[model samples]
Target: MSFIRQNSKLVDEFWEKGIVESCPIYDMHGHMGEHYAIYFAAPNADEMVTLMRRANVAKLCFSHHFSLWATPHVGQAPALEAARKYPDILRFYCSINPHYPDQIKQDLAKVGEWIPYCVGLKFLPDYHKIPVSDPAYKPALDFAEALHLPILIHTWNGSPYDGPAVLRDVVPHYPHVTFMCAHCFNNNWTAAGELAKDYPNVYIELTSVPGTRGAIEKMVSICGSEKILYGTDMPWFDEHQGIGGVLAADISDDDIHNILHRNAEKILAPFL
Candidate 1:
């Protein structure tokens, strides 16, 4: 770690000041309310904001857990309310549960009303038990493509629902939408890297990525820093730990900056 500090000024600054003012963090993947299966010490908007302030997080674009797991009618309110309450530091992704096509249609129709606060759409195909290429997600996909929205999809190594093969079929179709491969397709780095490299609009999101040693460095080597986006499943994961992992990686300060905020800022510019 000392070698990392010696080579990277950002790392040294973070070590000395707890947070680097020069490199503000923009968390692209996060969640709001508590999950039914897990316990969170700071799951609410207020608690999350407090944590963000301490970590020098510039913004956190999140989709509430309720919005992802529960029915749209019951889940969307919390995300919308949180974003409305903290417009400056917070933004939300409209979660689409493909399980209910009617709900998906209804939610996609109202997406415009949640604008500025709503940055894009989120899909948990793995949980929804539907492939990303399924017709059930077409309405939301069309909306995102039309608006050039960023869609964060929960991808895993070999998940039939949202795996690399399924994503390949879907990514090229919606060229306008920014596809954020959350968790970097989990353990399948090759597929994740290939997706980022093959598709200009596709990016590798570092949510659970940092936990695997050399993952960040490897991703940078594979797709370059510009194709990598910083993300932490906040409340579900520690913000400081996520940021620190990037700062401590065997990569340059410029790469760290890109992952932490630069790339995210570029992608979010149109919406903001």
Candidate 2:
């Protein structure tokens, strides 16, 4: 066989046949929702698991589409059902809306009821047009602190509500709660890395960031391998790129192991 055909055969024998296994891999950030129209459609829950399994991800923790696109409760129903069907492979974050304080209370109650199934909480302040610094959002932050659950916030630069600076005010208040700077604060990775260094409770989730090896290496250098995690904003982006970026980074094997799964094991220990 030609070299390309030989390589293709090897790939099929290993990855396709599920014989290639690395250290336990976990996808720390992802979403499943039907509302995502043609341009945004992520796979349904079943297809998501199949995708993860093919990629050798042992566990996946995500939030609902309804929570992000429709309403928190509507988004949660499918997540709950998926958890029931794929309890071993799936975990979820409780979506809490700061705009509706009453609904926030209600969701916290649901989170409490869900127990191990609800591993953490996700906040999309920008999507809801609320700032994390707003006092109205305190209850959700407080609930997460009380339970020691991690909070994954959608962050970006130049946004008054979701910017990295908001954490300066919020992280100090909930020292016990672990805060995942989702997407590495998107366009504001530098500031996000600084926050991770400043706050021991803060962490970096690598989703939707630039896929360059240098970018990944820089993040590892800034945040330390222990605070960095592997997350693909799946259904929107390709997991192969996310996985390949980390693999191609000029980091030690131990660091790769930590980012791929060990750090998540430590952060989500309560649930795992």
Candidate 3:
């Protein structure tokens, strides 16, 4: 069966319930919202569910885009409200930007109150013009360390987009906190491999890296299936393109299962 229909299929097909129950895909690191201009066209809460139902995605983790993460100064009450509005279908991660050092504590506090409901945190350091280990945002690193919440951080590997070197600073402090580094760390994958080896909680997502040769296999070799999870980073990566990328990786079926669904199933289990 086709894993996804076009975004319009959710509205056009009028087969939401059947569609949802029919398929078993679950997108762990995808985002949808109208508030951000980067993903201004991304689905809103309702639209997102319709698409999930259409794609037969059993659950979808709403990883809010880098825009909000970059602008941590903004109030997150509205985003929390939106998550509450779609409780059964949505799960939230508090996105942070360390540049707004004054606001980091307040944001973490608010997120703490929302937890067990809000189970994770996300970071887009590149967009915020910082790296994962930047000293200025040490409060966030420390809080995640203490709280033990999983953080889905953005890391790119190449030009046009840059990322942290070894994630050395944060990894040591937050040994218990789960860090799901997104985008396979772009082209700086060697650093990605090394960090995964060094930090057990440093999980990596096999999102847009499917087309690259041996990328998924290399990550699996270094980080293992359990540490690698399925992700689409959708709209930026199409459903067909994203899923195909993972399948192309020459890994075992079981490992693919972990990346595609099981890892996410495990990650969001507490909140679920």
Q: Give all TM-scores, in the order shown.
A: 0.97, 0.89, 0.80
Give the least accurate 10-residue stretch of model 3, judged by summed lDDT.
5-14
Predicted candidate 2 versus true structure: per-residue lDDT over 55-130, tens digit per residue:
7787788888777656544746777888778888888888877666676777788897786777889888888888
Off by over 4 Å in 3: 1-23, 35-41, 65-74, 158-164
lDDT of each: 0.89, 0.76, 0.66
lDDT: the better of candidates 1 and 3: 1
Positional deviation of residue 172's Cα in model 1 after best superposition, in angstroms: 0.9
**Regions of candidate 2 where Cα sits further than 4 Å from its true position:** 1-20, 37-42, 72-75
lDDT of 2: 0.76
For residue 190, give model 2's deviation from the true position in Å: 2.0
* lDDT of prediction 1: 0.89
| Better candidate by TM-score, 1 or 2 | 1
Better of 1 and 3 by TM-score: 1
TM-score of model 3 relative to the true fold?
0.80
